[model samples]
Target: MSDKKALNFTNWDTTFDNGTSEDGSRNCVYMSESLDYKWVATSCVEKINFL
Candidate 1:
């Protein structure tokens, strides 16, 4: 058996609020454990630390 989690349902929307088009350009979702697990939309090219 593995220790990794199965899934987490934050029910966050995958919309870019930076006035950017959601045409697979800025299509990335991330959650910050430091910020009380808040969701943030970012670029797919960005380097982030995953939990």
Candidate 2:
């Protein structure tokens, strides 16, 4: 639920660093479940139970 910078969903930014997302899907910022809760970029279309 952490974003690279302070951003609100109403005006969320879709920009990412040079190599931010592994799958090249930088739609939303979410915490990784299998990576010890590290922040990662994922597609906003995906349904995640956790926030």
Residues 1-51, candidate 2, lDDT per residue (tens digit)?
355686544422334352445566666767655656556666676678873
Q: What tens-digit string does per-residue lDDT give for candidate 1 at 1-51?
A: 287877666755444364454455667768866556678777787789886
Reference-based TM-score, model 1: 0.48
> How does candidate 2 fare on TM-score?
0.43
Lowest lDDT sum, 10 consecutive residues, model 1, at: 13-22
Where model 1 places Cα greater than 4 Å from the true spot, the runs are 1-17, 21-24
The lDDT values for all models are 0.65, 0.57
Give the clash count for model 2: 0
Model 1, global lDDT: 0.65
Error of 2 at 29 (Å): 1.6
